[model samples]
Target: MAEAMPQTLLHEALQKHRAGDLVGAAPLYQQVLKLSPRHPDALHLLGFLLHQAGQSAEGLKLVNAAVATAPLHTDFRGNQARILLHLGREAEADKAFRAALIATPANPDALRDLAITRRDSGQVVAAAKLHARLLCLTPADPATLLAHSGNLIDLGRHDAASALLRKCLLLAPALIEAANSFAFLQITIRDLDLARDWFRRTLAAQPLYAAPHSGLAEVCFFENDLEACLRHSERALELTPDDPQIHVRHGFRLLAAGHVREGWQEFEWRLKRADRIRREGLPPRWQGEPLAGKRILVCAEEGVGDELLYASMIPDLIAAGASVVIECAPRLLSVFRRSFPGCAVHAYKREGDRFRPVHRYDWLPKDPPVDYAIDAGSLPSILRPDVASYAHQRPYLTADAERVAQMRDRLAALPPGPKLGFCWRSKEVAPFRNLYYTGLSDWRSLLTDPAIQVVSMQYGRGWREEIAAAQKAFGARLHVLEGVDMTDDFEDILALGVAVDAIVCPSTTLVWVGAGLGRPVMEFGVEPHFELMGTGKHPGFPTVRVFTRSLAQSWEAVTGAITDAVRTL
Candidate 1:
C-alpha cells in the first residue's frame, strides 16, 4: 500500500510534468517520495526536473537513488543514461545506456539517445550503424533520416547521403535540412550549377536557413565573382557574426582577390579558432605605439612563396623604424638576409637563441605594440615596389655557381635547339587552383615537332607515369634532366629561368618568377583563370603570355597555343 501510494502520486506528478507545469510537478513528486522512500518513478522524475532547472548536484543524487531502487527498470535506467549524456559524463553514460538496452531490447528512444551520445563522442561509424538500426524501427522519421545522412556525409559517403536526402524530401517535401544537405553534396561533386539551383530551392523553402547562404557564397568564390561573393559572405556574417569559419572564409576570399587592408583586418579572427595559434610561448603584443626603436619578431606560418612575398615587407618594417627579427624557413635565410640587410634574420628551425621574449609579430596583430603587422602579401601594397624595383633585383635569386655551371655543362651535352621547361601540375590541392594544371598531351604537340627541345623540370613525386609517357612519346625531343637538384622552389624557378628559352607551365609562383626575370612564359589554362593571369597587361610578369581554353574545348586547344608560342620562339 505504501509503495502503491508513491506510484499513484508519481502518475499525477508525471501528468503535471507533461503539461509543462514543472512548478506543480515538483512538490507532488517530493510528497510521493516522502510516502514511499524507495519509489524510483517519483525519485527519477523529481531528479530530472531538478537537473533541468540547473540543480545538478541535488538532481544527480536523486537520480542515483532512483537507479539504485529500480535497478531492473529500463525506463528509469535509460532516463539516467540520458541525464549522464547531457552532462557529458560519457563513460558512465555509455554503461548506463548499454544496461538499459539489455533491460529492454526494443527501446527506440534508448537506441536513438545512445546513437546521439556515440556520435558526440566521435565513435562515428558505431553511431552511424546505430542510427541505421533506429531508422529501421522508426521508418519515415525525418529526424532519424537526417541524422543518418549527417553521418554518411561525415564519412565521405556523399552519394549515400544524397540518396537518403532524396528519400527524406520525397517523404516531406518541405524538409529544408535534407535539401541543404543534398545541395552541399552537389557542390562536393563539382556540379556548381546544379548545386546553385538546389541552394535556391532550399532558400525558397526556408529563408531563415543560414547554412545554404555559405554554400551560395562558396559558389560565388569558386566562380571568381568577387562582388557576389562579398554580398553573400556579408549576409552570412550578418546572420552568424560569431562563427569563426565565416570570418576566415571571407578574409581568405578578400585576400585572394587582393583587398589587403580590409582583408587583413578581418583575417585576425583566425586566432579565435583556438586559444592560441601555435603552442609556442609567443603571445600577441598589442601595445599600440610607434614602431621606431621597438624590437619585433616576425614568425613564419605558411609556404615558401608566402614567406618570400611577405619578406618584401622587411624594408617597410625597417622604414617604420623597428628593429625587426624575422623568424623564417632555413632554406630562405640567405634570401631574406640579402633582401633585408637592415633586419635580423633567424631560421624557424633553429633552437640556439633561447632567451628573447621581447615582442611577437604575426600576420594578424590583435594588440600590436609597434605601428604595424603585415603578412608577406600585404607588404606589397604598403611598400608599392614597382616593376623596376623587382627588376633591379633581376638576378634577385642566385644558385650555387658550381651547380649552375654543372647544370649548364650537363645541358650542353644534349642536342639542343630551343630549350623549353615543363611544370605540368601545381602542388596546390584546391580544385580551383589545381584545375589550371597544364595537360601532358599539350606538351606532346610541341615536342612532336622536332624544332623544340623540352626538359622535365617538374617537381613532386607521383609524376612517374607522366614522365614515362612523355619519354616514350617524345624520345630525343624530351630531355628529362638528372642530377639538377631541384631542392627549393626558389632554386627551381632560377634554374628554369636561366636554363630555358621559354618556360611552359600552369599558373604558379614560377610563372611570376620567370616573367619577373623576363623569360618568355606561356601559361596554358582554362578561361576564367585567364583573367586571373594578373591585373595589368601582366601585373606580375611582363613576359607571360596567357593561353586560355575557349568554351567546351579540352586542353588540346591550350596545347595548340603552346605549340604556336614555341614556333614563334
Candidate 2:
C-alpha cells in the first residue's frame, strides 16, 4: 500500500508539474521522496521544477542526486547536464552530456546541444563533425540544417554552406537565422550589390532585426559609402547595444570619419570580445596619468607594421617619466632595443589577441615591479586623443647608424640612380585584401625602368623566385639584399629602409617605419583606412603621401601613377 501510494503521488506530481502548478506539485514530490527515497523520477521532476522557478543551484543538487540513483536514466542525465550548464559548470556539464550520448547514441537533442557547446568554445571543426553526425540522424530537420550551415561557413566550405542554407530556407522560409546566414554568404563571396539587396529584403521581412542592419553596414563600408555605412552601423548599435563586433566596426567608421575621441572610446570595446583573450593576473591598465616612479607593461599587438605604428607612443610614456616594458615580435626585438634604449624590450608570441612575453625574468630592475599593463594599440587612446596631440610627437625611431651608413654605401655602389624599396603584395592575400596590392608584373614600368633600382622589400618564401622570374621576364633591374634575411631581421630591414632613397608600397611595415622616421613614402591604397583618420593622410607623418585609385580601376592602370611619382623622385 505504501509503495502504491508513492507511485500514485509521483503520477499526480508529474501531472501538476506538466501543468505548471509548481506550488501544488512540490508537496506531492516531497511525499513521494518520503515514502520512496530513491525515486529518480520524483527527484528529476522536482529538480526541473526548481530550475524553472529560477533556483538552478538547488536544482543542480537534486538533479545530481537523481543521476546518482539512476545512472542510466537518459532524462535524469540530460536534465542534470542542463542544470550544470545553467550554473556555469561547463566541464561537468560536458561530462554529463557525454554520458547521456553514450546511453542513447541516437539522441538528436543531446547531439545538438553538444555541437552548439563546441561551437561556442571556438571548436568549429569539432562542432562541424557533431553537426554532420546530427544531420545523418535527422536529415530532414530544418534547425539541424541551419546549424550545420554555420559550421560549414566557419570551416570555409562556402558552397556546402550555401546549399545547406538553401535547404534550410526551403524547409523554413520565415526562419531569420537561415535568411541572415544566406545574406552574409553573399558578402563573403564579395557580391556586394547582391548582398545589399538581400539584406534590404531581410530587413523588410523583419523590420526591427539588428542582424540585417549590421549586414547593410558592412556592405556600405565595402562600397565606399561611408555616410550610409555609419547610419546603418548606428542603427545596428541602437538595436543591439551589447554586440562587441558591431561596436568595434562602428569605432573604425568613427575614426575614419574624424570623430577621434568618440572613436577611441568605442574602440576600447575590442578588448571585451571572446577572441580577445583576457589577461588574468595582470595589473590594471594605465589610464593617462603621471607614471613617475612607476613601471608599466605594453603588450605587442597585430603585425609588425601595426607594432611600428603603435610604438610611436612608447617614447611618450618614457618622456613622461615612467619606466616602460614592451613585448614585441622576435624580428623587432633588436630594432626596438636600439630605438627605445630607455625601455626594456622582449620577444613575444600572440595567444589569440594578446601578447605573452617569452621571459618576464629579464624585466627592468624591479626597483618598482610592473604596476600597469596596456595593449600597444590602446596607447594612442590615452596619449593622442586628437590630431593636435600627434603634432608634438617627433620621428621616434632610429636605425643603427653604422648599418645605415654601410647600407647607404652598398646601395651607392649599385647603378648611381635613386634606389627605391618596393613591396608589391601583402603577406595575407585574400579577396578583401587583394584590392590593396598588385602583382610584380603590374610593376612593369617601374621594374623595367633603367633609371631606378627597385629593391625587393617583399617578405615571405618564393619571393626570390618571383623576383627572378620578373627579372627574366623583363630584364628588370631589381636586386635582393645580399646579407640580410629581410623577413626575420627587422634591424637589417630598418637599416635598408633608412638607406633607400624612397619607399613605394601599398601598406606594410616599411610604410609605417618610413612614416615614423619621416622618410618620403608613397602609399597606394584602394579605400579609406582608419589610420588615415578621415584626412586621407597620416596627420603626424607628413612625408608619407597617400595615393588612391577607385575600385573600378584595374591595379595595372594604377602602377603608371606610381611610376610617374617615382620619376619625379
Candidate 3:
C-alpha cells in the first residue's frame, strides 16, 4: 500500500474514510497528497478529518486552499462554509453558502444550512425562499418543515404557516420543534387558548425548556391573567437566566403587573441584548450617576415613537444641570431640538444595527469628553422609578407654533363636527405585532359615522388608497391633510396630533405626539402596554387611555366601543 499508485491510495483512503476509520484514512490521505500535491479530494477529506479531531484552524486553512483551487466544486465550498461558521465568520459563511447554492441549487445540505442561517439571523424573507427551495429538494424533513413554518408566520402568511405546521406535527407527532412552531402559529392567529395548550404540551415533552414558559407568559398577559404572566416569566428566567430577551420581556411582564422596583432593574437588561444598536465609541452608560456638569449623550433607540416616549425625562436631566446631547431619528431632529431647547439634538443614521454618528457637537470632544451615553429607553429605569416620578405629561413635546395654528385652521375647514384623528394600523403588521392592531377594515363602521369628522393619521406609504377606499365605500371621507407626509413629517404629526379634537389609534408615533401634546388619546390595543404600569391608564399622560378587547371579545366590538367613546368627546 505504501508504494501503491495515487488512484489506488485515494480509493483506499475513501474506503477507510467511509468505514469511519479516520486513523487508517489519514495515512492513506497523506500518501495520496504526497504523491499528488494539490489533490482536492485528499485535501478536503484530510482537512475535515483534522476538524473532527479538534484541529479546526489547520483544517480551515486546508479547506480554504481547496475552495481556492476548485471554487466551483459545491462539496468543497459547502464544507468550507461550515468551517467559516465554526470560526464565527457568519457574513463570509453566508456568502460562501450562497456561492455553493449557485453551484448546486438543489444541494439539500446547502439549502438546509443556509436557510437555517437566514432564519436565525431574522432574515425571514430570504430564508422563506431558501426554505421553499429546500422543501422541494427534501420535502420529508421535519426540521425543515418546522423552520419554514416560522418564516411563514413572520411573513404574515399564517394560513400557509398553519398548514405547514400541521403537516410537520402530523409527520412527527412528538417532535419538540414542531410542537413549538405549532404553538407560535396558534398565537399568531390570536388563538390564545390553543397556543397555551400547545405550549403546555411542549413543556410536557421538555420540562426544562424556557421558551414555552415565555410563550405561556405572553398568552397569559394577552388574556389578562397577570399572576400567571409573572409566574411563567419568572420560571422562564429561572430556566434560561442568560437570555436577554427573556429578561427584558419579564421586565415588561413585571412592569405591566405593577412591580415597579424590580421591573426597571430587569428592563435594563435590554442593553445587554445582542441585537441592541452598538454605541461602541460613545460614552459609558450613565447608571443613575451624578451629572451636574457632565455632558451626557442620550441616544434614541429603534424609532421616533420611542424617542418621544422617553424624551419626557429630558427636562429632569436638564434640571439636574447636565449638558445634554440627544441623538434622534432624522425626522425628529427639528422637533426634538425645539422641544428640548437646552439640549443639542443631532440626527444620526442607522447602519443595520449600528449607529453612525453624522456630525458631533462640541460635547463629543475627545479629551476628558462625553463619557456617559445612555439609550433613551434606559432613562425611565434611572429617572422615573416610581409613579410619582413622572413630570406630569402636559405636552412635554412641542410642535412648531405656526404649524399647530395652521393645522387648527385646516381642521376648522373640514366641517362643523368633532375632528377625530386616528391611526388604524401599524406599519409592521407581522404576526407578533398584529395582535396589537385592529386593521382599518375592522374600524370601518366607526370611521364611517357621519357625526364625527375622521382624519387619516395613519402613516407609512399605502394609507391614502386605504382612506380613499373607505371614502368610496361609505361616502364619509377621512380627511387626509395635503402637504403632510405623515410618514416623514414628524413635526407635522406633532402639529396635527396637537390640533385635532381627539386621537383614536393603535400604537404609533402619533400616540406619543398626541399624548405629549396633552390631547385626548384613546389608544386601542389587544392589551395595555407595560407603560400603563398595571393601572389601566398612563400615569403621566392623564388624557391617554387604553381601550382593549379581552380574549373573549372581538375586535369589532372594541372598535364600536371606541366609536361610542369618541362620539361623546
Candidate 4:
C-alpha cells in the first residue's frame, strides 16, 4: 500500500511536470520522496525543476543524489552531467558524460554534449572526432553537420568545412549559421563577389542578424567601395554597438575616405582589441595639448612599415614643446635615434626578461615619470587631421650621411644606366593582399630592359632564387648591391634610395623609406592604402607617385605601365 501510494504520487508529479506546472509538481515530488525516500524519478524530476527555476547549486546536489540512487540509469547520468555543465564544472561534467556513454554506447545526447565540452576546453581534435561520430550516427542532422564544419574550419581544413556547410545548406536552406559560415569561407579565399552574394542572401532571410552586415562591410572594404563599406559598418554598429571589429573597420573606412575626426575616434577602439599589445602601468594617454615641459612616451605599435609611417608625426609632436621619449623596434632604434637626436630613443623592452629597462624621462634622472604615453599610430589623428593639414610634409627622416656617401660611391661603380630600385612583393602575404604582390616572373618585361639597371630592394629570404631565376629567364643584368644587407640594413637602404635614380616597388616599407628620404618613388599596388586615399598621392611624402592596378587589369598591366614610366624617366 505504501509503495502503491508513492507510485501514484510519482505518476501525478510526472504528469504535472510534463504539463509545465513545475510549481504544482514540486510538492508532489517531495511527497513521493517522503513516502519512498529512494525514489530516483522523484529526485531527478525535482532536481531538474529546481535547476530550471535557477536554483542550480541545490539542484545539482539533488541530481547527483538521484544518479547515485539509480546508478545504471544513462538518462539520469546525462542529466547530472548537464546540471554540472550548467554550473561551469566542466571537468566533472565531462566525467559524468563519459560514464553515461559507458552505460549506453552511441548515446547521441551524451556524445553531442561531450563534443561541445571538448571544443570549449580547447581539446579540438578530440571534439572533432566525437562530432564525426555523431555525424555517422545521425547523418542527416544539420546541427551536428554545422558543429563538425566549425571544427574543420578551426583546423584550417576549409575545403572540408565548406563541403559540410554546403550539405547543411542543402538540407536546410534557411540555416543562417551554415550560410554565414559559407560566406566566411568565401571571404577567406578572397572570393569577394561570392561572399557578397551569400551575405546579401543571409541579410534578406534574417534582417535583424548583425553578423551578415559586418561580413558585407568587409566585402565592400576589400572591393574599395568606401561609402558602401561605411554604410554597412555603421548599420552593423547600430545592430551591435559593442563589437570591436566593426568599430575598427568603420574607423579604417572613415580614415580611407578622409573623414579624420570620427575616424580617429573609432580607430581608438583598436586599443581594446586582443591582438594589440596593451601597455600596462602607463600614465594617461595624451590628447593633443600644449606640453611646454611635459615628458611624453610614444610607444611603437604594429609593424616596421607602420612605425616608419607613423614616425613622420614625431617631428610635429616635438614642435609642440614636449620632451619626447620613443620606444621602438630594435631594428629602428638606430635610425630613429639618428633622425630625432633631441628625443631619447630606446628599443622596446623584450617581454619575459628578468631585467627590465629603467624607463625614466630624459630630463628627470631620478624619477621614472612622464606626463603622458601614447601609441605612435595615434599621432596622425591629432597632427594631420585632414589632407590639407599635411602641408608641412617633406622628408622628415634622413639616412646616415656616411652610409649615403658609401652607397652613392658603390652605385657609381656599377655599369652606367638609369638606376631603378624595385621590390616585387611584400613580406607579408594573405589571400586578400596577394593582389598587391607582383611575381618576379611577371616583371620580365621590366627586367629585360637593357637601359634600366634594376636594383633588388625586396628584403627577407628567398629573394636570391627569384632574382637569379629572373636574371637567367630574362637574360638581363639586374644589380644587387652585394655588400649592402637589404634585410636588416635600413640606414644603408635609405642611402641606396639616394644612390638610385628612381625607386619603383609595390607597397612595402622600402617605398616608404624611399619616399621619406625625398627620393622619387613610384608605388605600385592594387589598392591604395589609407594615406593615399584622397589625392592618390601620399599625404606625408610628395615624392611618392602611386601607380595602382586598374580593376580590369592584373600586375602584368601594372608592370607594363611601370616599364613605360621607367623608360620615360
In the order shown, the candidates' Cα RMSDs to the true structure are 7.4, 3.8, 3.3, 6.4
- Runs with alpha carbons beyond 4 Å of true place in candidate 4: 1-172, 184-192, 221-225, 349-368, 468-477, 482-484
Which of the two, 3 or 4, has more TM-score? 3
Ordered from best to worst TM-score, the candidate numbers read 3, 2, 4, 1
| Candidate 2 global CA lDDT score | 0.82
Tens digit per residue, CA lDDT, model 1, 467-557: 6776686642567776554446455446556767878877665665565446788887654442232242444345778787632356887
Give the C-alpha miss distance for residue 51 in model 2, angstroms: 2.7
Find the candidate with the highest TM-score and give its number: 3
In lDDT terms, how accurate is model 3?
Answer: 0.82
Q: Tens digit of lDDT per residue, candidate 2, span 62-171? A: 88889999898888888888888888887788888789899999988888888887776666787899999999999989999999998887666878999999998888
Candidate 4, pairs of clashing residues: none
Clashing pairs in 1: 286-367, 286-368, 287-369, 288-369, 310-376
Q: What is the TM-score of each candidate against the true structure?
A: 0.66, 0.86, 0.90, 0.74
Taking the candidates one at a time, how many backbone clashes does each contain?
5, 0, 0, 0
Among all windows of ten consecutive residues in candidate 3, which has the lowest summed lDDT? Answer: 353-362
Each model's lDDT comes to 0.68, 0.82, 0.82, 0.81
| TM-score computed on alpha carbons, candidate 3 | 0.90
